[model samples]
Target: MPPYILPFEKPILDMEKKLEDLRAFSQAQNIDVSFEIERMQNKITEMRREIYENLGAWDKVLVARHPQRPYMLDYLAAMTTDFTELHGDRVHADDRAIIGGFGWLEGRRVMFIGTQKGRDTKSNLERNFGCAYPEGYRKALRLMKLAAKFGAPIVTLIDTPGAYPGIESEERHIAEAIAVNLRDMFRLPVPIVVVVIGEGGSGGALGIGVGDRVLILEYSYYSVISPEGCAAILWKNRSYANRAAEALKLTAPDLLKAGLVDEVLPEPPGGAHADPAAMSATLKAALLRNLEELDATPVEQLLEQRYNKFRAMGVFGEDAAPAPAASPAPAS
Candidate 1:
């Protein structure tokens, strides 16, 4: 029902509809097209593989921001148990943009943090379209501290256009909140995992994004700024965002190759929106694998690893470390 569905999605949906109709026809008329159904199913699988294999960076960005793409709440509903939501920054009113809670995922006690955009018109307005204010970032900092204090591993879901840049947010010290999160995140003692489930825009995304390991969904993007903002600043033309997106190196594959993210979890064919359950399953497995590796690490080691992971990214000039050689060393 969302507007951004790719052209390929239509035929896939049409084939599925036909299959459903055939099932109904068989029940009603006592006719069997079992062989025909199997053939059509194979065709669907082939089409899906082709479509998923060739998604461009821009297409991936659009898929990441798809209106129907599953958000943090969807993941929580599907994967977590006994979710106890925590609220407020203690110094200010609670922010809905960042949702924090203690929850159990696959029998592991963990703290969940994420930016939440509203799904519909009214909820979107209520959530400020996932744009965090200073209070939201501050609240996230508080939750991260709680997770560390309780020794619970943290799982953060990033999905936002950016932090709110309105007058009220400035009054509350937006930059200060984000800076504090980044500064404190490096010192936290537990395993921290960040997943860019959708748009990872600027400090807003990074406010809760610092972690021991970062994973991006197949179609998601992690960028220092939005493509439109980058275009306006660089060329003074907003229409050049597509070009900026290409040059920004913001897609999952680009970031992976650049060594900015730890892993890229594949999404379902036609993007996560086309098959949320499958996407969630894939993400859960990735999360579990990362958590398993991070769980046994001591708090001090976790902090050190996280600090080094971020500190090593984007160093410039003579201070930058040499990249690994094209061919790996021969086994001893």
Candidate 2:
């Protein structure tokens, strides 16, 4: 199959095609075209670097949603060992969209939870395109609670467009479920690490997003809503998604500047999809480093810091007059 191409990737893709044809001709003719091939390869590398260096927020969104970008399972496979998946919320049916289980990460057993999107039509249908329902959140919370009980650290991978918006999802109380996760996660005694691995959209992402340290991939985006959804609401036209993406301040660099993310893990050139193994290695190292730091802190202090970290989000204006200083205490 032809490699999936994004709108902004046309130039690179065209060059790649030419390179492929050149290689084929060179092989067919038994010709010595090594010099030309090397030159073209260097040019392609330079072009990719130029294109990725100055991407706008909207361009980052496109990279975050790239078809071949590594997802939760890919990271799990690369970073964890002795995996064991746990299913169901017990009170409701199991949700395929959000998966959680036990895994060993760098010699420490941890609970792994993440939104899972599929690669093809049938799989996407089954996974609901990574949009979770109430049960999914509940399942995630269940795993979180289990991690705390076992004194295991938790690692959550976020990648979702949003929670499922169907009437059935509402009826099942999706909002309440996510709210409960947000609340309970704050109180969990074990260290928790959250990573925005792809399109972290709305409550679906937040359901498993709260943690002691929140990391975002270089090309990933995390926002209260998807760009398309924001465009529809603000402009009544989804075509304005590019504008919405810029306005949302959802890119990794933006969030890092705003102090919303603890760290931004760099992706390989051309984005994570271009080199997933390298991306995974970098992510695993970051996770282990942060987890070790958190593990060394007292549980009470960790919880307090986690609470304070989230409380500090959003803009807050200074008190208008600094509340006039208390009148000089009575001398008498």
Candidate 3:
């Protein structure tokens, strides 16, 4: 299949194609046009840099959802070694939407868990488009507990539209499953690192999102709710998703400024999809650095700091002056 192209990327791709054709023609004619081709290549680089630098929230949203973007399994394959996938929740059937197992990272044994989206239509159906059902969350929690017990650090890669909203998921108590993971993750004695590799939406992402250090990729988004869902709820139309994205402050810079994310890993020139190996290298370095720092802390201090880290999120309007004792409302 041809590579997917976003509207904003058309011009860049077109210029690149034209440059390639020019170079081919030059070679065919046995002419010396190396200088000219180099000049055009430089121009294309500058244009791409400018476009990526000034991308608006909507552009970022599209990038985050780009079909070619590397998914969880992609990262795992690129960044880890000796991965042994363990399956089934034990209480229910295994969910393909979320997968977890033990892996070797920089010579350290760690538990790797993430929401898995398929690369094609059939696999996407099987994975429910990366939206986890209740069992998925249960399985994640189970792996996390095992990690904690065995003295393995936990690494969670979040990329999901949201938790599955199907009636069957609700009937199975999806919310409760996610909530349990949230509560248990905080208390784990081992170090935990989380990265938002792509679309981090709502409780689906949060189901495995809690960690000592939370990182987001440059173009990835982490939000309580997806922009399209928010648009539908507020304006009764999904087309307003772009505006909704702006309003939600869900971008990496926004979240970093708000203290929701500890770090933002830079992506390749265009985005992660443009160069998965480069993106994976950056992610691996950041993970190893953070994990090293986290490993040096005492378990007591680690747990306490992790607790305070999450507790510090959100804005609390400065304590309002206590209202003057309700002025004798009883007289009425």
Per-residue lDDT for 1-332 in model 1, tens only? 43555654677778878989988888898988898889988998888778778877666777778889999999988888888999999998899999899999899999999999998899999889999888898888888889989989999999999999899999999999999988988888888999999999988999999899999998899998888898999989988888889989999999999999989998876778878899889988888999999988877788788888888888466766567696698999
Worst 10 residues of 2 by lDDT: 321-330
Q: Rank the candidates by lDDT, best first.
A: 3, 2, 1
Question: How well does model 1 score by local distance difference test?
Answer: 0.88
lDDT of 2 by residue, 102-177 (tens): 9998899999999999999999998899999999999999999999999999999998999999999989999999
Model 3: CA > 4 A from native: 320-332
Q: 101, model 1: CA deviation in Å?
A: 0.6
Which stretches in model 1 have alpha-carbon errors above 4 Å? Answer: 1-4, 14-31, 319-332
**TM-scores, all models, native as reference:** 0.89, 0.95, 0.95
Ranking of all predicted structures according to TM-score, beginning with the best and ending with the worst:
3, 2, 1
CA lDDT of each candidate?
0.88, 0.93, 0.94
